[model samples]
Target chain A: MRTHHVTCDDDVKLLAALASNRDAGFEPLVGAYQRRVYGLALRLSASPQDAEEIAQDTFVRAYRALAGYGNDQIRALALRAWLYRIALNVFHNRVRVRRVPTSPLELDDGDGPAFRIEDGDPRTRPEQTLIASETERELAALIAALPPHLRVALVLRHVEGLGYAEIATLLDAPVGTVKAHVHRGAKLLRASLEAHNREEAKVEALL
Target chain B: MTTTNRTPRTPRTPRAPATPPDASLAEVRALLGRLRALADVDAPAALLSAVLGELGLDAADRYFSLRTPVGQIFVAFNDRGLSAVMRGESAADFERAAHALLGRAVHPATEPPARLVAALERSLRGEGKPVLRFDLRGLSEFEQAVLLKALEIPRGEVRPYAWIAREIGRPRAVRAVGTALAHNPIPIFIPCHRVVLSDGTLGRYSMGGDQIKRAILAAEGAAPDVLEELARAGIRYYGSDTTHIFCFPTCGHAHRISAAHIQHFASEAEARAAGYRPCNVCRPALGA
Candidate 1:
């Protein structure tokens, strides 16, 4: 495996090139941040295609705004926040155009297929794949059922592993409110997953 | 970094004859980790190229707003649109302003343009007459007052579903007010889209869903950004799998009620018979 290390100086160089209108500068920046930004968009949008579009838009918008950027400004603002903000705007626009009910499970564009975990892939050593698969499904469902705010908050907090203050800054809410959102959101996830497990067991018994 | 190198994976030992691979819990987590690795799948190359094609290098100062679903851009006017609609700006503040105007998630910078400002002014001045007025033509003594009251809602702003219920003196007739707004034929002139979910989401709009309503607002500079206008402002509680209720009342307090909380009365007389007074706050029937 190849190891890649990103120093702050590398970002500074990229920022300078991007500001100076050098197309090559975007390559390194895109490589370093695309996955993180795309992942954020997908979680927010709950659809891979929408996530991709939002991520692309985020970069385009970021590039356009790069000229006015300074090193101090870049250090102060997490690129993630700016990118996520752009992606969320794009997602909100989708929400409006499609008028998809605000529920996460209801994919507004029905053609965008649902993402499913592999159930029977043979590459894995078989020891406890079934148990893991079940758990994965449960986690996905729990995420889908959460209210939009709670789900986004939890994904940014735990899954992305951002600190509470960082999340509060990203969300533009008070730190206390951000903490509450994460705490309640996690509790709700645990309860929902537990309930789903119980219900699945009952259905299996019936079958 | 070598492009051909795959991410390192923990090597799995050959399975023991007696112990099947299915029995290994550690491997299950590893499988999940691999699936998670796929989470960063990039957008298709064609899509990326297309987006880049649209992005010109020197338009950094311009402001553009794209609609949801990712293909169409509604407004891409240069910085003039932003300045025409907002207060002041710093250099880097341009993107931030554009972002806010588009209503994505960022820190609250400025409240977008007030929804009702120009529309209310136009209505008060009686300019831009409705191309087609519905039953509101030759308004009755009582009806004229109600219609004028409904016009008070500015664009990108909202009043409660029940507020209109009380405004027309049909204090018990929230449903009747909805009917009146539903049939509001003059959208831009009457500005019926301003009425929203009591909790501030784009509720059921007579124009369409919240998006079209937002598009109209965006056109009017009523909201700075689409997300700011569309973001749900209040709490929603789901009573069951299929039933959800918005907890904020039209009157501003957070009140939880079920779908069945409001009885469906077939006619205005039937609603009156049920003794539910028109909510004094919203004046449901009054468009003003």
Candidate 2:
């Protein structure tokens, strides 16, 4: 999904009030963005519990650093990007805690509860349905198996739909490298799919 | 060489090195597609509430100067090994506050912490006011417009940033929208904390960063941890008597669902009249 700018004169005013200290200003900001942030948090963390913590942390961080946020440049950074960075950090730190290792299973399926195949907008056409169900499952498995950097790059580019430039800023990588990663990632996925299909056919023949 | 007409032939160029394996492309595509599918995933009420409460307390203490003092603090570490700190009040006070809040304390590195203290001092003095409000202040006209639309997102709700960007007539500015939010000013009220990375990651927050972000959502009445907390309290989505529904008013692209789509509706007519069924994904009616 694409992001649009929404700062208004009132936001500016509230921001001004916030510069010193203004709890009153916090509500409007909350009223404005609570859903967007929380929603994004849910998606990134893949766990309501984790997302909730990340969302609150994002705000507290923004509040504390309101002094150094540097006037709207953060605007150049999407709430998504900023929050993702925070979430990633949180996820990484959590990993350091020696929790039971998360399996390679994808959250939508293997890892967490598997989604009911019939779930989704049933009104969708058969063709779209087939593509969505089969291709999507196969693709997710392929992605889960990729290297972390490549996987993240693909997620940001295709899933997040971020621009190369924006991604460069977020990932701290050159645009050329980002492009290469995306292209290579796509190629690898295509190859894996072909290979998987072949294996499935071989197993079926034996059966 | 071309002028020699067929007399001089140039040697063929050697093929370039084989491209490296991306090994994850299909997975990435699937993951991306899954994000679109899960767009309707609702933010839990209990979780959001906790996060908002934490943020409310922090914001109240910081910008609002509410009854509380030193609401929150954010720390960052750069590649240069330089560390920065942004606290609500005095740098020293904020440091103490952090120690108190986190229940653990580490001595600040003399040089970096000192530099951070200096920056906070200048910020408190009002010299970097623009810098302080950069999240909203630095936005371009278009970005500002997009963010304004994003701000409309209600508590415990989410909409695609791309859709919002499209609503602003800048369909291609999806990334820009995320950027705008990253620099959001008056974060709690603007609720930039509510925004997420499109991949569904909670994304990053500059102030108090991630943990603080989580805390704020918890306070807002959203149930990010409803399941866990409920489990601890001996709760479950399937309760005794009444059937519950969790409706999400956001997601304009979503269809209007009625009772029939639900597994166990009150009655058949109630389900059909709505003309559409509730999604099984989030169970708008079930509150799952």
TM-score of chain B of each: 0.32, 0.37
* Residue-wise C-alpha lDDT for candidate 1, range A68-132, written one tens digit per residue: 77745655545556666666666566666866534443322233333243232344326675565
**Stretches of model 2 off by over 4 angstroms after superposition:** A1-22, A27-49, A67-81, A95-101, A104-145, A188-207, B1-41, B56-288
lDDT to native, each model: 0.49, 0.48
Tens digits of per-residue lDDT for model 1, B1-288: 001111134222222012233435464345335434334333344444434546642222233222232122222222122221221234246346445544331233233234333433454344574222222432344444444556776433456556665655676666666666665533445656666544346556654456766676565544525334334432211121122212113322112334556333222344444454444333332222
In the range B257-281, model 2's lDDT, one tens digit per residue, is 3435323223223443434454344
Supply every candidate's count of residue pairs whose N, Cα or C atoms clash at under 3 angstroms: 42, 125
- The CAPRI category of model 1 is incorrect
Off by over 4 Å in 1: A1-9, A67-77, A96-138, B1-51, B56-288
Per residue, candidate 2 scores C-alpha lDDT tens digits across A92-115 of: 455457355242333242333332
**What TM-score fits each model?**
0.38, 0.36
**Weakest 10 consecutive residues, lDDT, candidate 1 chain A?**
A106-115
